[model samples]
Target: MQAQIENTAGKRLWIKLSAVAVVVALAVGGYMSMSNTHAAPDVSFTNLKGEQVSLKSMRGKVVMVNFWATSCTTCVAEMPQMVQTYNAYKDKGLDYVAVAMSYDQPNYVVNFVQTRSLPFQVTLDTQSKLADAFGDVRLTPTTFVIDKQGNIIKRYVGEPKFAELHALLDKALAT
Candidate 1:
């Protein structure tokens, strides 16, 4: 009855794997749902151009606020993709702001922006007040995707999957 024992063992292993998959799915669902309820803070960004861009004024646009530091490897690695994403969607009502952390030198931020020829607005949070307002964002590459109605719909703590992020932006902008 060796074959019978093997069949039973395989079935038991399959059932265990299926249960683990279900648990993982539920956890991800809960995490995603948790991000949909918070309203975006009424913050203003003064870009390197010395222009004021406010969240309230951008109520009808899908805004991406990226908090990044020049020294963060992950942040540096994701810059090209972020630029691509912004260029691809900027005309489709996507407003992107790259915010330099308070610790990042303004000169370095300016050099990075200039060297990269970044198309989106880049701002500096020199006093960290903007960081404090946006949920005390202390991480180097925290990103918040705010929906058209000024609600923080998605928060990515590290590098986001660009494809998934684009899909979410599509859905948010369609409305």
Candidate 2:
């Protein structure tokens, strides 16, 4: 009878340890997912005028790095709102950089910008390196709002509502 009780107690202890291990594993996984979701990588590329630009160089200003493609309707749709926002805040230390991905010829981007009258600086990502640098840019109109300290404060992956985008910009500018 004593041996039977000892065996039962050991089984109970094993079950408790297994439950604790499962909880620990779940906790670790949750933390990892949360961290990965927030941590976006820094990217660097040249502007349309052949000026080298990087997240590190815009440390003192709130930078909006927008990834776009000339063929994307949603990307083109957001240009006017972005232009308005940039024009309003440019004097207040808000910098906008639009990186055009998957466009081989700069003329395509230049033509699009000219047709739309986009005033913000535009860049061409010939190799899609900028998109790859900032995690998987699965969508055309991905925007990253970087704080003055160069940390990515917010990320939008689609045609952003102007109000929502402006709210994020205001928050970043306030910081």
Candidate 3:
């Protein structure tokens, strides 16, 4: 009876350890999938004013290249925070540009911009070239924070954590 009880207890411990291992594996995998860091691809899109703005041209400044769509409520919802983030950091060598996804209609983008009185550069990815350059951004509200050296320091798929973003910006600005 004693031996049987010990074996049962060992089996329970093994099962618990296996469950914990699986949870740890999944946590690491999820984090690895989300953290995509790379060099900011060189590309250009037509700004609202019809001038071409290139990511390569903004190499010396911290740039936030955001891919968004008018149809995405989350994208629209985050614009105010984005604007505030830009306004707060622009003077410290931060450059922000919002790129309307290729699937977004130009009229809707224009209307959104006008209604919001967006202060930063708003551009259109009409040809989808810019999207392709930025890892084929098919998701609205995807944002990339590029350092002054043109490396993408962070990529947020949805609304970013404003506090953490501000911290990253602080570090990026100091560089």
lDDT of each: 0.94, 0.82, 0.91
- Backbone clash total for model 2 is 0
- Per-residue lDDT of 1-175 in model 2, one digit per residue for the tens? 9999999999999999999999999999998866553434666777777788777777889888898887888887778888889999898889988888876367888898888888788888788788888885758889988888877777888977888878887887887
Q: What value of lDDT does candidate 3 attain over all alpha carbons?
A: 0.91
Residue pairs whose backbone atoms clash in candidate 1: none
lDDT of each residue in 10-119, candidate 1, tens digit only: 99999999999999999999987875468999998799999988889989999999999999999999999999999999999999999999999999999999999999
TM-scores, all candidates, are 0.80, 0.78, 0.78
Tens digits of lDDT, candidate 3, 1-175: 9999999999999999999999999999999877756788877777999887788999889999899999999999999999999999999999999999888999999999999999899998888888888888888889999999899989899999999999999999998
lDDT value for candidate 1?
A: 0.94
Clashing pairs in 2: none
- Stretches off by above 4 angstroms in model 3 are 1-37
38, model 3: CA deviation in Å? 2.7
Residue 136, candidate 3: Cα error in Å is: 1.3
